[model samples]
Target: MSKHLPLRDAVLSWLEYAGSLSPKSHSIVMLMLQPHWEDVVMAVAAVAPRDEHPDLYAKVKGDWMLDHRTLLVESGLAEAAQLIAQGVSVPVSDVADSFVTFCTGQARVPERWLLLNATFPQRTRIALGRHTLQTFTADELRQTVPAPALNGLHPWSLDLDLIAGAPFLHVPDPSRTVTRRPTWFDITGPRAEAQHWQALLPLMLWDNELLRVDSVFTVQHGRRFDLHPPAVPTTIRVYPGSQGREEEVEVRDTGEFHVRPIHLSALTAFCTAITKKIDAITAGLTHTRRVPKLRARRLERAGRHVVAAYQRTYDDYGIWEVEADELYLDYVIALEALLISPDDGKDEGIASRIRSRAAALFLTPTERERTEALVRRAYDARSRYVHGDKIKEQSEHEKLEELRALRLLTLQIILRWLVLTPADTGDLAPLLDAAAQGTGREQHIDRPLHAFFATTSPRSRPADIVLT
Candidate 1:
């Protein structure tokens, strides 16, 4: 046995160490591991903790060691490692101050679910994914839920009486100018598990033609994001009479938010199919991130990144609130994730790859010149900002426009990618590359992109581009 271990190994060894007992009995919970464990895992893998690789990407917005330090102290691995440095091997996990019982055998994998309250003009009942969406009055809940369950409502429930019309108080606060959004819709029935439920609602939203799921279910409508955006309630209000009015209006709308169920079902299927791949891609971020599961054909590297980037837009690409520079980084990372490959970062042409690929892939031949310039400029600004160089100052409005361009470009690419990425391979990078070099497979790529566009109404296009 080695007298010493690397910091990363020391932590893992401690985490796994069992005292005088069979280690096989105790299983490690993969989910319990810190979220940013990727940097350490990658760094320690195949090489020692002190390695040749600079691991610049590990710095991750300049705080790579933030969690590591806490993990060491909390786990008491720091002391154990010091003892190891003095030549005494420590089974750090055995002597740890804390204990987490790791259970083995079959147990249900609990998913991190997001729930939010939203208002709709019409009280509609539509099946969202595998769940139904509609509001419930107190009486409705009482009748819907078994009497025993309704009687056994959680202690936190505002009202025990579900027979009343309103169980929760909608108390108005006059002290504040902005009151919370009134909850008009409640999604009942067995909630289907979805990682990116945010993406599903916009597919039905007549207004959210863009991929901004946040707008559909804004933070104003209570948000719960363990991993991704909340489930959004969409309004497909058709007539002026249907829209709610201050004066008492006839409740003509009964329960039934009907849509071509195929659209939302398809979106869920698409998101669910890619969930694991997206999880593996995002869980680490760098080359060391977990790879997709076994496949007959090798998955294209760039294609995997493309899907990861698309997922990021809907997931935690900071659709809610992020600083200007941070938002810039988010958008650039997305663009790079879609465009730049692990192999491509070795050279000086990183910006060139981003600029040319983005323009070539998404724009017309005439559009490429300006598009490429725009990407280059945007990428350069990101580079300067990250490297601690302050560039020319712009007004807040000007900065917003720049961010919007990056956002739009990222969203448009994501939508195009949805159709192309039915599988793990068939990267469009090659088609874009060949097209740039005048070997046109224009239709091969454009056909799917256009198909997605055609299936989606012109109204679904982002508000910026849509005429009316």
Candidate 2:
């Protein structure tokens, strides 16, 4: 067996071997060595003070400079020796664990090694017309765009050096000759995971409208012995036009790939309509005095629930958790806030108020019948969910569809309230009495439920029975 060498000697030999490799290999080796260089240098400097170890420290320091492609200078070693001689303590580690980390390429730095090899197409653009009026400075733009965060930790941070100048969004691209369109935004993250994009969706749509997200194309380095990594492209595109649409295409090494298309346009349309209604609701809440202070406060709380439900619907959380049960509860609470009076104490009274409100608000008889049924079912579901009853035997897709219809109806109710109370607190009693007298058409009512509410009933249900 060969004789064992000291930590300084071992590191020096490794550096010499690393420097002997090709330029590309040498660059990777340098990246591998960069994070631990300071600690290794300090270890070498700690040994430099001893009379027996001065030559060994100088040799190790010289090898480090060679690995870094710096001139093998004696000045750095000399200064380190002087500092150590002057009683500046050089902190030394065991070097064993650090050496292991270096060899395994698991350094303490949150450096995204994969991103270093990524090829960004030239000229990415971000349109912020819906959110901001004036052009943004580079710093302001960075804050406006969503950054990738991993478990509350951002691996690659945004810096001025990473971005180019004003009037355009510029990023580092290896292909100097290519000029691409400016509609794309290049974002960096660890391995281009799906959750990061999923988390970004709700935030993109929360308060803004018409967010046209272009395809996110990632050209990864192929695992082959070539001078440069071949561009193996993967694309995830989100189209937030009418409804939301997500298209994904992934290419594997063996030329195998998969394509999945998710259509959420109807949902997007519903959410957009609800957002407009909420804006109206907010304005009405601020200006109208026909509503009592206490009732207005309750309506405000209900508005918060509606907004939360809307945001949560788009979030990455699964359809089961986000849709039917929880969103329905928000609808129920909001409707109750608007329709239920302070003195109404019993469930029967609350149900009567809901039915009466539905009759007044719904433009057509079919809408009234369907909405009344939805309210009754939703109230049952909400009670079951709240009281720990397992919602048994319903498929997730079916439940989501049911909840979607209820959510649309709930939004219509809220919109109707806003329309009626456009200037002052509008009375619901007249509308209710008209519906009761079978003369609802005579009332000069504003119609906001045309999108989802049907004029004629497809299937006959129980007629609207007013509870005494």
Candidate 3:
């Protein structure tokens, strides 16, 4: 009975307060994102890994006041942390009305699930984040992230993977190197949903240095530097085929394959938690008006370079997808494209160029410590992997962890760079160089990326825990 009464008022109130700040408050921010839609799903026996705000630990579960406040904050109706602490499945605007009758056709829906109000249709589905697992072939991650969502767009999960017995869209040449067909996480979902799938796409090409600020580099409990035989990645492959075969899948229009993707439960858990923050950051205009407006001016100029980097990171195989060593090198190349300038002195090698410039762009004086050693060690590991030296040292799964850190850092840079400075025609390297010269915490990227790779990072939780 109370669901629809207040949201319209809240938007109006925000507008009224914003009007005092600017004469053209309504025209301020627009998140410009066009999502690359591909089918997405990954599940490990449906582990419901959820996040509980530290605040939630102080209160009881299902507290009405807290849920109301969380909903308000996520919808931008109230001033609060933007992350969704509760895993309530929000509806997408495109399919919101699709379930109206099913929602209210029956009495009160047995108890507490999406209550209907007098203005039910008017307020059907405005918030969108599917609280579940997303699975897809790691290779199908060729598309760009954050499918564009304009004013008031919300989407419900359709779960096309659940479509039973859809015809097999298979690779005709079984010998052409692909052990399995690519099942992509379709960017078909609305903004919030697209952001999640997009972030995960590049991890195959992606580290864990438990970043600590004071030390500049803390030795984590990671053998990430140790050379272990390469892992047969389970992060994105749904069917679990031969090693490196899926990476060989070409990015052609192979039509849609209604197949189960390589589902990495660990990856699903990591991405599920991190994406809430990602959605909050990428929405440009609320510029969470990312209108939620991403500044497209720079994207227009550097679009070629950035998209190519993405292509190399996710689409190119021989360089990135073959082995952990090649994957590391591919990351180096990709990072260089976005951060380096033509003017960068050749005396500074590309790796140092990438490390220093990326630090300028992403790290703070305090945050740099965590990744400082990581970059150095990753380069060392690159040598071992590229040259195929087998170390008898123990395998701590450090290679995978290192990629986790790098991939996440890379993802943040790409997303933030998209919207941060649209009007500037100059290369990102100089501005970041200038920011480095300046002294202020605000000068750093709004959210410090160093913490994401820290051992304390929320993304490192065990995959089996059912937080929800």
Candidate 4:
């Protein structure tokens, strides 16, 4: 068996590296460097800590300094020593081995390192961007690093795959009304086979997944990228009948789902796609700074005061149990839908009043045009009673035609808002022109718009085909 280095030396060198990376805001970045008893001895010798070394120092008490490297970095002296005595200390000499043992073992060391490595770059970005107006979000975290081994690091040591596969969950703070720290998780296997699970726990508790960036606001063809894990069957199916006969189908799928592993490169690509979309959406609008009359002056004023806080609630705390809480958002969507499809047979009181107010506040210019046209048609329908002129009967046919026309046009306008940004004016102009022409391009023009409303529709294909 190879002799182990002294624990002091190993701690010193590891501490030096970690100390170098610490920011002013934080204390020592104590990465618990673990090594076997024999290797620990060699490392301690290499580090050579000197401070009145006792003859019986073999059982040195709590965390001891190995100052050969100007700092100390080692596993918890008390716990690690106990672990080594138990013969479960992973026997390895390299950093990679240390990392793997940290991950696979029940010890907390692996989870800490995984978090440190993954978040170090993000913290660096935040520190740099702090001086600028730019902000960082999980969606904006798409840095392309060179292959790790090429940097002369451990081969097969660092699990960058775990970092890439992780899903970010951000929950909004209900009272503070801003996003809290995002939680990241990697559902890579049945039971989260590594310390990576601890790294993801915070975000999951906050229900971060439900606070997803609106796919609507992302790159036009992004959802089409479809970089999802394959469908793990919750139930399996079996055919019992002979070939060409009336077959009976039996389903037996009953396992926790797992998908083919997504590569780190693919994760990079996905983030890049979202970044591009955010870039497009905010591009021209930011430059032009043309705050449209999407809302009334008073409402706009109120929105300015409240929207930040409103957005914060979703951004920080998020809608917990989204399927259950999403109905809270339906008020806004239903209002928009009702603008196009008014309940003519039903009597309106407070509901219509509130809907009309929302329409004024939320409807864009094109949307307002379509909505006003619908209102005019409804007045003529007589099926809907409204204060109108005597010519309502004569305009009945025109009103009905206008109803469908405005509904379709309204849908397209909203879809455009969803799919393209004013910054993408160059790419989107042609599409808008095609839509405006309303000729043979109706289906094509309507595709993106229809797709948004038809997300649950089987006829729905990918967003890329409809948008691009």
- Candidate 2 matches the true fold with a TM-score of 0.40
TM-score on alpha carbons, each prediction: 0.43, 0.40, 0.32, 0.29
| True-structure RMSD for candidate 1 | 20.6
The number of clashing residue pairs in each candidate reads 3, 4, 58, 28
Give me the displacement of residue 395 in model 4, in angstroms: 39
Give the runs in model 3 whose Cα sits over 4 Å from its true position: 1-322, 362-366, 383-396, 439-468
Query: For residues 1-468, what per-residue lDDT tens digits would candidate 3 score against the true structure?
Result: 244223323333333343233222222131101011000001100111123222111245653222322222222322111111122222233122211211222111111011000111111122223322222222221110011111112232122222112111111121121111121222333222122233333231122212100000000010000101121111232343587443433211212111122323433344444444344433433432221233322222232333233334332121243444555555554455556655666774767655665565544454455545566666666667768885224334554556656655654555444334323233556666665666543444433333334322333322222232
lDDT of 2 by residue, 62-130 (tens): 452222211111112212222233444322122222332222221121111111111112232222212
lDDT of 4 by residue, 88-187 (tens): 4322243333322221223111111112101212222211110111123333322111111111132322233323333222221122211111222333
Residue-level lDDT for 411 in candidate 4: 29
List where candidate 2 sits over 4 angstroms from the true fold.
1-295, 315-318, 322-324, 342-347, 439-441, 446-468
The better-scoring model by lDDT among 1 and 4 is 1
| Residue-level lDDT tens digits of model 1 in 217-335 | 11111111111111222334444444574343322211222334344444344344334333433333334322222111122333333233332433222333334655556556656
lDDT (Cα atoms) of all candidates against the true structure: 0.39, 0.39, 0.31, 0.28
Query: What would you estimate as the lDDT of candidate 1?
Result: 0.39
lDDT of 3: 0.31
